[model samples]
Target: MATGVMWSLCLLVCFLIGAARSESRALQKLDTGGGAENARAPPGPARALSAPSIAHDGRLVACSGKYLLGFEPNGSFAWIVPLGHMCNDSISPVFEGEQVYLVAEDKVIKVTPRNVHTAEPALEVFFSHNTTSGRSEEIIGLAISGSYSSLFLTIRNRGLFTFSLHGELQWSVGPALNLFDYHLGCKRNVSGCYFDSAPVLDQCEGALYISNTEGQLYSLYVDNRGIRWIQDLGSHGKVMTIAPGNSACLYIVFPRKSIVVGIDVSTGSISWTQNIGPISIEKNLPTVDSNGWMSIGSLDGTLYSISPDGDMRKFLAKTANDSVIHVGPILDCSGFSMYVAKTIVEGKLIQTVGDYTYVLAKKPSFILFTLLAPATGTVYWTGEYPGELSNLLSSSDLNDFTIDETVVLTLLSAAKTGISNTTQCYTRRQKIACICRQAKAKFVQADPGEPSYVLLLIFLLVVIVIQAVAILFCCIFWRKKRLQDNGLQKFLEKRRSLHSKRRILGKKILELEQRAAEDASSNEALGQLGEMVKVKEGVERKLYESYSLGRDEPSLEQQGSSLPLYHDKYRSHSFHSSQKESITIFNMLSDTSSSEDGTSSCSDDSESCSGTSSGEMELDESKSAEEAGPSNTANVEEGVQHELEKQHQHCSAP
Candidate 1:
């Protein structure tokens, strides 16, 4: 359990350390955004004024002055048509099946390819119409019915005109009603009308929606060419563009008013008005999706999405270079199985003309070509051009331009050094796909190592810590348990058992051996040395010798002898031979006697020798006793008597 806990702790620490390191690596990657963007740089063309139109066959049709070019998705030209005259600047080409319509200054020509599937097919004029002849009657906008039967045209300073597909004039509405009269507090002079925006035909309701510069939005019932209703937008607040809604309502944007008004198409009455704050410049026409999301871009470089309920969201902030977002936001489908349901648009302007100062370099260029993401409004890839942008064209422009859903395109002005009034094309979806593939590859390569390294480090550290803690706990617990038992005492007993038993026993035996050896030596010494004297039975000898410090004196009391004196054979051992022996006691009682000689001589009969020696010794003793005091003489007399008795007993018995 302890080991497991330690391992867990170690793993945790490793994880933390790895996380910190990975965080650092991630920060390093943060600085690589610029490089990543460079790796997927957008494609560039000379210039373009507006989005390119997609034909029904998935081809992109772009206009460059009198030349109309059809391009494949790779930007390769599929076919080109020279119109012999300049194309209308404000309007785009209308495509229907294999047939395309070009609106020129004074004529409308329908061009068709012999074989659209061929690499470069033969093209010829299918029809032609002299729509107008007046010099000032230039066509500014054009629209075609969804059924490809009716064509709607908006001419400059002229009213709205409708015609059949066969070039027959159907009906015309002109001079929008005057609702702005300055004389009346409630009105202003907006009656000087001119049509600039394109006409919109609603097949569902059999109505056409058109607005003029004179501030009137006319909703005409198309069936009888009768007026449904007219809504005055006030003064120069002409509608810039109109976006039809999901229900009976439609949305219209006014450049001058900087607002979008929602109108009830059934009654031609405004349902709601949303104000867009003051911007750097004009805003593009709004685009509404099937969902109630309306996307619009401003010259201030911001893009906004407003819902039908009037709730607005600023989806994208101003771009990096402060370029005007001339092309309104678009929601492009990724078309990938994984992200099929996910709507992601791609690309936006890289550099922008900023802070206009009325100078050539500082002047606003109005050239923006980008693919936008619908989810976050992020630009994934960009297509570059040098021409002014007119407007954004998408598949939604199919009603008017006959664009196919498969061909996602944008058109821009291509005018450059010597080229004037030319245009270019961009495959927006292709560019977006390129960006996605490149970025994904790079990200996939970068992700694996850093995170794995972090996790491995974390696991190792956790294991190490857990193991250490477990070991430590085990050590402590064991020590405590040992102390709780008789560990100390047992340890001491074990130490004693480890001692040398043989050495201890040997010491004890050596001590006993030493004692025995001493005893044996003493016994031998005693056995070797005989007693000092050995006597044969029958007779025994007693020797006595007396000495005094002073010289001998003759006195009556000294004549008595107290102790017995006898000459001994060992008398030479008592003193040297030259020195005379001095006797303090006198007695003559001994079995053994010696004459006046230095050496001892033993005799079998001792009577004669003893009598002589006894007489001499007695005389010497009496003289020594006379020198002693009366009490000394008495003690001498008793000691002489006892000595004589001992000598008699020794001589008489064994």
Candidate 2:
């Protein structure tokens, strides 16, 4: 029987345990799934309208709406200025020294940086000139000389114009014969062309290579007015202009025919012509070193870096559709770095530097995000919107120390409150690795091991299992305890029945007591109010009697006085009266007795009468009560006393 009872208890416990488990599971599901949605980090800012361009000193500049501005790498706007309505072009502005040059519909204007480290303290217009004839000639290209002392401008239909840094016109040379006119048999190579590509000046030879829209390339003597040689690339797209380290050759792109051809500067003879597939070349090509190795892009959007021996290396690949239109010139600052501007769909700038790039997507939005790559196509660190960043002109001063300490610090701060708020979690880990990598790139450790990830998963599973087991045991124990107390359970059932009846009766009694207390409070308040009304009546009667007669008048005469006489007497009475005399008069009037009896009954009444008469003279010296009432003398006194009381209460309150 004992064994059977134990088994029965165990079974009952199991059943109860199962029920509790089911309920707990339901509660957990409701808590986790029904309460609220999971919170996610905000998205980064949108892209800028134009790609960021860098200045000589490494300051970044970009056109943001109608304003051109400079910003630090960490995305702080250093300076900004309005370009007015003249800012219509999508092309990034070019900068030199403290001035930036911009091209509009018909004019080219220069503006000072505004935030000059050393100040002559003026945003002087360095130059302004209109190059329009009725319809206005479009300014298609601009290139500053290596010294930045001379400007080379290309205007549609008007040819190339040379000017000094101060806008002085040096020469206006154009109307060159089209190569198509010369080569009648060669089919059209480029779709359309203007002198869009800037002239490449070879100082060693005193010669300039200028290509025109008619698929013609010209080699002109800088000192002499003569064309050295002309090559028909068969189509017009853009001429890839580059000065090779050999100093004797110039590389030009024949985009219409998808060819990259090299020409000898001395004789203008074709040194080498390499076919590089069908691609549209837009801006001037990017060259690494003086080795004649250059990277050029096609309209179809493939980027190729050609070797000195005319061999092509397909290093990076992106389609034209994936690329931005009217992208500024691709720049290769040194052998270690390459820069390109890509326009995002949202009309902001995305600057790719070497293997890393950042997308500056929106306004006041510090989505200055970064993308890093170790190899040709491998992406390294690629999350966290840093913040809004300006242009990056050069990577020369971006040392490991500066990058890790200052640059990283700035990025962390800019990201603290925006889309990057949660980035702090990752930054703490990344900062350690970044510092290690900065010390020695190869010293940087790899990510967490597979074993570590597995261990974390195991830890979570263990916790959940332990909690489930505890809950199951607890429910089992509770059910066993309930079953073991069967005899006591019967007694509890009987006690509960009696307790419930008592609870009902107790509730009814409490309701009746509450009603009785409310009635008693109402009666007490009414009684207090009735006493106040009786006191007011008594006081009024006394006032009437006092005002009816002078102090020296006989009681009989006072009693015989008319209502008008009483009112006049009240108006002429002394303003001040003794408290005792007033109280006695009030009692007498309330009793409706004789004034002699009232005065004789109170010893203080006689003294109060004499005191009141003396105080009357002093009262007359002050303004009348009517004037004092309007002046708020009573209200002022009450207000001061109330303020003091409030301060005392505040100080004393716990």
Badly placed stretches (over 4 Å) of model 1 are 1-50, 115-135, 176-192, 277-283, 318-324, 331-654
Q: Tell how far residue 546 is off in model 2, in angstroms.
A: 99
Candidate 1 lDDT tens digits, 1-654: 999999999999987787666544433322221112122212222223234665656566766556566655434446656667766645678765567777765667677754544576444443344445544666666666645477777776667777787767888867543335413111344344576667776544567887766567778766446677777776426446787654455777765556777777778777788866323233245666434456776544556666655667664353423444444443333311000011122332333243221211234433434554433444444433322222123212212222211123232211111111221223433433343343333434444235655777899999999999888866654454323464656534533322322233234334533553365223222211111111100011111001111222232222111132224211111111223333221222244653333323333265665455545554454444334334433443354346555755887996
TM-score of each: 0.43, 0.40
Q: C-alpha displacement of 79 in model 1, angstroms?
A: 1.0
Summarize candidate 2's per-residue lDDT along 1-654 as a digit string, tens digits.
Answer: 999999999999987787666545433422232211212211222223344555554455655445555655444445655555455344546656667777654556676775444455424444445555564467666765544367777776667777788767777666354455563211354323356555666544556767676556667665444567776654334445444323355667654455677766667667787765344244434443323356554333345666545666653343333443222123222221233322323344445464333434343222222221112422222222232332221221121111211233223223331222222222222332332233222222334335555666899999999999888865654454323455446535544433433343344334533553365223223222223222323333433332222221223212111000012112222111333223211112225444554322223447765564454434443344344233343443344346555756898999
Local lDDT at 54 for model 1 = 57
RMSD over all Cα atoms, model 1: 43.4
Q: How many clashes does the backbone of model 1 have? A: 42
lDDT of 2 at 582: 30
For residue 390, model 1's alpha carbon misses the true position, in angstroms, by 23
